[model samples]
Target: MRKLALNDEILLKIEKPARYIGNEVNSVMKDKNEVDIRFAMCFPDVYEIGMSNLGMAILYDMFNKREDVWCERLFSPWTDLDKIMREKKIPLFALESQEPVRDFDFLGITLGYEMCYTNVLQLLDLSQIPFLAKERGEEFPLVIGGGACAYNPEPLAEFFDLFYIGEGETAYDALFDAYIANKKAGGTKKDFLLKAAQIPGIYVPAFYDVTYQEDGTIASFTPNQPEAPSKVEKQLVMDMDRDYNFLEAPVVPFIKATQDRVTLEIQRGCIRGCRFCQAGMIYRPTRERDIEDLKEAARIMLKNTGHEEISLSSLSSSDYSELKELVNFLIDEFRDKAVNISLPSLRIDAFALDVMSKVQDVKKSSLTFAPEAGSQRLRNVINKGLTEEDILHGAGQAFEGGWNRVKLYFMLGLPTETEEDMKGIAHLAEKIAERYYEIPKDKRNGKVQINVSTSFFVPKPFTPFQWAPMFREEEFIEKAKIVKNEIRSQLNQRSIRYSWHEPDVTVLEGFLARGDRRSSKVILKAYEKGALYDAWSESFRYDIWKEAFAETGVDMEFYTLRERDTDEILPWDFIDAGVSKEFLIREWKQAKAETVTPNCRQRCSGCGAKRYGGGVCHEGQN
Candidate 1:
């Protein structure tokens, strides 16, 4: 490990110096002579935010459980600290020992989202490692990636040596044990990677060769090495509760984080089966932790952190079968402690509303609903399964229950969307506003505030709409304009506020989400042109991305705005996510025909979960 001369003056000059400092409680430290394998668990973001993530904490705890293995945390420094490090010539260091990241045997980065692509390259360069995998030789640490983004890692494949798809609880340990055995035999990095590639769920990009046809579609992806598997199967833990819960005692940050309170996951997947939702598909076979387990985790977390609020996190909290009982338990447990319990993803239903009323005082709380589409027909096409009456009835209940402010979430550019469907958004908002006025003037609050936030729909892998074309930026903006104008002209009231996400940004995201290995060049080039934090609206640069696409001779529109054939080979075809391609095709056909698939918990649609030998997931079972 290269050590830089410590300059106290410069350290004091940067913001959040604690981020650069390497000492924290509960951090692992093992002697170089004692440990056989050194792993750096990296989150491609800053310290305060990364430390709070449950995935990082779980892997950190799991890897450290092995006496022969030592794992440390690494995160991308903020722009202010990055400036200082560049000026001071300091390499990226681990948060535990202050050692450079290059010294570790494996640099395991968790890819949480597409926006963090540029940050990965920034961290690699800051660590003094070659940004591209091909440029790095035997001396470099093996680079691996995991997390939700690993499901579709084609766009960033060139940077990572391998990708651990799906759940990492079991696969990570299996790979580490293999690495430890290989390293003890004095094996080379390539030799160990070859051996690791043989393990299920580990995808080694170097062993695979990608060829594109004249039309820019993938022609073939062949494995050059015999040890590599022809196809990689994603890893899934059979039991989540028996696994690790590392969020019980989170690392308190010196500065405020994006979400400062404790978060307890009530469930793992969604049962609604929204076609446009990547999370819904990626996290299949909706699994809910036991209510008793959740309550205990919350109690322990609150006792340890003294946090004033707790967020019940999941793809959809309302779908949890025991949601009412869980919320009641939490409210009773924390009511005297003055800790407010928050449920973020609530559906528009009476049962969900009843649960909310039990935990929160309606007068003091704000409600949020994600109808997703404006009209019933559009909702059916997306498999949202939400009726127009559900929205109106839910809004009326909110107004009658004394909640004055409600936030509604919708999407603009869905597959097979029409102008009439876009106008229905305004109609829904106006109906909600009228519902608010129907309440007695004395019972009504000062004013009812309706906030409608719309975002462009982006096609994602492993979904029914994977072959669908995203609406062009101009088309999406025109639709947004229609929705905006209709809302303003109909409501004529400042109480209703309408906002839409930028369409160009969504187009770029679509390009990255479904891109192949060749797209890494565009990402690195864009990063070189100063594109970091594309997820944040303030830091997004459309021009830089366009320039990068142009220099690489890559047509962004071809990837984002072109409809694909059902028989076309997808970049993620080699990855088996437990859901069959036939099922996805069936769902796509059902979506186009406006047929709603029943929730799996209610009835099995033969989606292949039973093949794993587990019946439909329920409350008590793992």
Candidate 2:
């Protein structure tokens, strides 16, 4: 049995004692003395949240597969335990071996969201590691960063020694072997980093110098070291069906995770090509897994974890080619065992309704639709490809199928959005309520429940909207109020419920999403002033962030609320994300013109992901 890091008394004081204890089912264990490399993998969040990330589980499995490496897991302690640990001088340790992270060979932190910036500092501080990469010497573990947030790492560049700019499955093994080779040859930290910089996907920010113009825009970004590549291209697994192990036997957390179910990823990348969506652009050239392979993987996952529910994970679940077949297979396999099958991100069309009706309880389940815009013109601008008629038709099908509740998701402040667009949201919800009444009284399952939600738009890097300007906090609130009032005047007002996201949080996310190297100082200062857990609405302090930005002389408007010229050098321009700038610029022009582009399944738009030479690019060719 592995010894617990915290004593019985200390564990009792924490909210979830299962978080600190090790020896969970399916968790790997090895003698540290027998391994050549001791790597500590961290998600920089609470254990419950971190354990649910599929990327962390994939890397953990990959790293431990090596006989010469012993990889362990660590997470940021909750604020309750954080205070106690600091006062008692308890160093942060990994769960597997109960060993201090300060003693590990390499500490890799995954940066999934921008709001977790402050929590990164907490993880470093609690581990007794240097907060700045420059302060850490050869004696300390090398701190590396990766994930979607790493696409624009300049804001947090000074803190991470290196950033992996690609899929973990494609490049991690090569990077790890290179590190092992450098270590056996008696290499220093600097020497190892210098060698690691030569790898295709590895980026050592220290080797690069960023210069800003008088207008506060990136003037020049050039490499200072010979080994560092000027443009680090994003890596991807070409043949996911053959090369990728979607999800092997992962560690079943003792505490219930946020996603406490067997998550089977059906595919990678999205063909929808929504201009405002960063994930769809970054994960280009949609690739799907074989149905047989997915079935086997799901079986293994369920067997290893004993989860009663299994969710089909994907950017667009309905876009999968074999979705109907896969859903039918799952229902046939698990329905007898009383296992719940979750199918999210599906368009509420006839096929979706048919499948959902079979798998889900019509009375309890709610139908969801992402129109992404209120008016048809705004929908065209964002390339959502969802028509108002499509919405009503789908709702009609769902209502006929005994689902009385409907949820509509839209975005406010989209580029070129007008007041009419805002009112159109309420109009659409009213129409859905009308459609619910169109059903016979005896056929209706219950009263019509139409829930409408809207969030302020925040343009992200690598997307066509990357150059678009964002609304100020007050403007966002005003727009939300406009939609709320319009909903109140609806004929079926009682049936309609409207909710909007926090404007302050939206603006803050805008600042972080598009910030450059200069914004790092503001983040550092904010964290010093108790800005941890900023992702949580209750923990976020808008005044603290404003003060930090003011003190650092970093204007939030410089990053947000300003449209950039087409030729301007963005913060994330240094990395090649497979999609060409030319394609993105073309799409941006189309967005302004309100022109719709066909998806990958219909015709190739030449987005430049084809250079990788696989996936949907050659789907019809073969």
Candidate 3:
């Protein structure tokens, strides 16, 4: 529990020294004796990246608001620091108090994605705590995980003692209260975890016995106690407006983070229910806060952080009901001081462009649009409602306006995609270039630049494409090469640039995304083989993943390239995500027929979310 003195010479040798020093504006500090439950909110990455996460800020603020609880931040040290820590035997410590993470009563890790699994183990090991739940005694810190990855916690079930399945707003409060009562009774960690498992959204891994068949499928999962629910329902915050108040002022990092400026979330969830998008399915029923509240938050954030740029972020910023008014208000408020307003998720529409032109002061800022697919038929198959005309019109508007650089995002191997459909990607880019040329020279502000980025499609769970087969690495690479060759041969435009994600990396992601408990062994093995950040292409080692899969006797292709039957139970079935299986199956059928389902906000396709509703539709709300 001793505070480690800063070695200035070693700090200078490492990258981003400011990341290690965690003191910042709006950070919470409290006396350990004053709190009943001491919680360490851990993010499995460096401090700069972890501090930037809005969820961490919200939870930190909420827990500290409680007079009886104190929560602090914990992050994995960088590689150089990790080595130094091992040599010096420095235990992982919290930022606010500089106390060892092992000293906390509860260690709560917020898992955002699959890539951070290794860092979780590393963090635990560095803290001198047992990595596995069974290995750790009752005296050890209670290890719990939450966030998006917790929705499918089967893979990491062996490591975590419990999981908070959904939103933490209400569940977190319930958990801490239960812990306090258990502590008053002088209960053990096991006793407390057993009681905590009875909570609505909590899942205790120790109480469940997972049996696997010879084919590596889950045979059964039996609970040891009657207190556990048969299926844990994901917790959802009914009111987003009330929740936004919990995040009044986020901590500004000392160093430049990935998102270096103030980010105000304009809305939650997406109404355009694209079949391939996991985020849309996971965050169902789009909800927006009041525009006045958003403007006020932005103004406060700008004044506190002195951030030159403010990004209005959401799944789709253009879909916000009062986007024009929000933009105008921000522009009018910040124009005199030269603050930049950025709409991060603008849809491909004329009105969105018009709003952007009015709000964005910099004419040189690049515009980005995601058509998702090349052709209209392919787009329909993925439930991407954007038509070819929408892209053309949107690009035309950008060209007609002062903006010259346009970036378009697309996917390579979608379900039911063909070579002709792949070729259509190049054809569409050439057409956009042609449209740029058609614009008058005076209107065309500068040389036109068309940047196309293609990424391999990885089938995710809880989506319409969950049962679809992903293309093999070889096939994906071939298709990408074909698209690149076709574009160069046909259009031969110098201003147009094409880049693609590595297919091998996508194959690894595919294996992890839809994998079962058995995949955990593969992940652990790969991590031991130095797979720190597999998501980054430069750091990804395909051989390590391949070797891990081979050693574990788990077939990567069987999980990635094989389609599952509709009646089959998935690994994530035990966790209820609010969406019905019947609705997903129907959407899958529609996708196969190349039929598009309209956004639920516009029309009710009976997706079953109305069962838990504030207002079923926009008209219903009206």
Candidate 4:
């Protein structure tokens, strides 16, 4: 029998009681005396969103496989329970044992998004742990961070004890062994951090020193201690199939998750090098799994989880070498079982129609495509290899294949964007609508529905756009207005519907994304002023962040509006993401010239990922 941290009366008061209780399908339970170490794996958001992350699921399964380590799950408690926990003086607890999280050996938080910085603070506050890393003694759990956000760990450096700079699978075993050995030898926390800092991909921020110039630009970043390395090389898993185990039985949430399906990660990275995309740059030289392995994994996962829908996950699903074969196998194997198959991030031009037609969707789903930018010139600037011909031809094929609804995605406030570029979004949608109308009346399903969505672009670290300038909130709003008004003036205006995200939120995200150590003061101040769930639009208060910036006297515009000089020292310069800074600078210059670089398959632009000696870089070699 299990004793819940929350009693029945408290459970009855919360909106979702299942979120607080631990028991769910396939959740690991271990005796405290048996395990040598306890790890609290957390995603600092609500349960549903955290459960949807495939990366977290894989790492959770991997950690639990070790007999000496028992990993449990934790999420940011919702607002209703958050207030109750504070008023009742209840400490944050992990779901598995319902024990206080502060008692764990390690608290590993997956830093997925920049907007969740405040939530990270909230997680610490509720855990009854010190907010700053320096303030905590040896009694506290070693707070570590990973994921894409770890690339720019400077913004959250003061809080995290250490950051794992790359893929989770590459270095965790070594880390775990080090932690256990350090404990057996009775090492101090500082002694352990110094030892961990020497590891290939581990970064201990306290062991590094940053000196800023008079203009607020970073002057130098150097190792404070002899044990720390000058640069932390990002760890990457070379062989996708052999390096890690595919998650067979992911914890099934009691409530419906954002992505309520078994995610089959077909590949690890992307071939497309879009300048504005942090993911494409950070995850370099895509590596894919074998089709046979994926098929077997899918079968086992379906049986284990009892999930009806399965999605093929990748940076670009269509770019997988044997996608058609995999899709066909899934269709043939599960056609009678009523299992739904989905392939996201597929290029519309590349045999996408055939794959979509074969996957028998009980309800016809909308065909979605991301052009990234509306105009061809802008696309070349971003190194987006897509063309107008490619989009129209694919949309036409989809129309003939029985999809009446289409969704097109684009970004606003990209570098070198012009008024004509903004209007081109509507023009592109109009062309797609005209293609849909070409179908005969008798053959048509219904009125062609084209939903257009545009999100404000935020310059991210480790991308070609890292040094680029971003637009202000009003500028972003005016750009969206231009696109909206142009759509209204179109010949096919009735067929299209337009939507855009909050510009204020984008400004805050941009600030956090490119910010450095000084930004931590603002994040902490804002959190103290009741800033939680900034990722959720309803809970986001832009004014609180503004006041924090004013009180701290930190320049938000210095991070967002100013176009940085290439020679200036950037905060994340010391991290080697297998991509050379010289190559990124070259790409950035090419973007200014509106020149396009071919994708990885066509040619290698010498981005330095070849040093890893695997993935697409060494595809044909022994």
C-alpha lDDT values of all predictions: 0.82, 0.90, 0.82, 0.92
Residues 1-622 of candidate 2 have per-residue lDDT tens digits of 6777799999888799888887899889999989989999999888999999988988899889889999999988889989998999899999899989999988999999998999999989989988889999988999999999999998899899999998889887888888889888988888988988988889998999989888888899999999999999998888988779567788999988999988898999988899999989999888888999999988888988888999999999999999988989989998878889999899878998888888876356888999989899999999998899999999998888898898999999998999999999999999999999999999998799999999999999999999999999899989989999999999999999999999898888989998888878998999988898988888889899989988888899878899999899998999999999999999999999999998888888999988887778977732
Q: How many collisions between residues are there in candidate 3?
A: 0
Query: Mind giving the per-residue lDDT tens digits that candidate 1 earns over 1-622?
Result: 5243345786677777767665554466677678887888899887777866877777887788788888888888888878877877888878776788898888989888888899999889889999888889878889999998898888988898899987777677778888888877988888888998988899998998888898888899889999988889887765767763445666556556677788887777677788998888777777678788888889888887667889988888887879888888888887888888778888867776777777786466778878888899999999887888888899898788778898989998898889999998988888888899988899898798989999999888999999999878999889999998889877535777999999888998899889998788899999999988787788788999989999988888888889988888789998988778898899999988988888776666766655554325533233
**Model 1 Cα shift for residue 575 (angstroms):** 0.3
Q: List the residue pairs that clash in candidate 4.
A: none
* Candidate maximizing lDDT: 4
**Candidate 4 lDDT tens digits, 1-622:** 8789998889999998888797889899999889888999999999999999988999999999999999999999999999999999999999999999999999999999999999999999999999999999999999999999999999999999999999989898888999999999999889889889988899999999999999899989999999999999999888877886678889999999999999999988788899998889888878889899999999999999999999999988988999989998999999999999988888876478777777746457999989989999999999999999989999988888888899999999999999999999999999999999998988788899999999999989888899999989999999999999999999999999999999999999999999899999999999999999999988999999989999999989999999999888888998998889999999999999999998888888899988787788897531
Query: Candidate 3, residues 191-290: lDDT per residue as tens digits?
Result: 8988898898999987877787776667887788777777988777657777544466677777787777788877777788899987887777677887
- Backbone clash total for model 1 is 0
Please provide the root mean square deviation of candidate 4 (C-alpha atoms, Å). 1.2
Off by over 4 Å in 3: 1-6, 361-363, 615-622
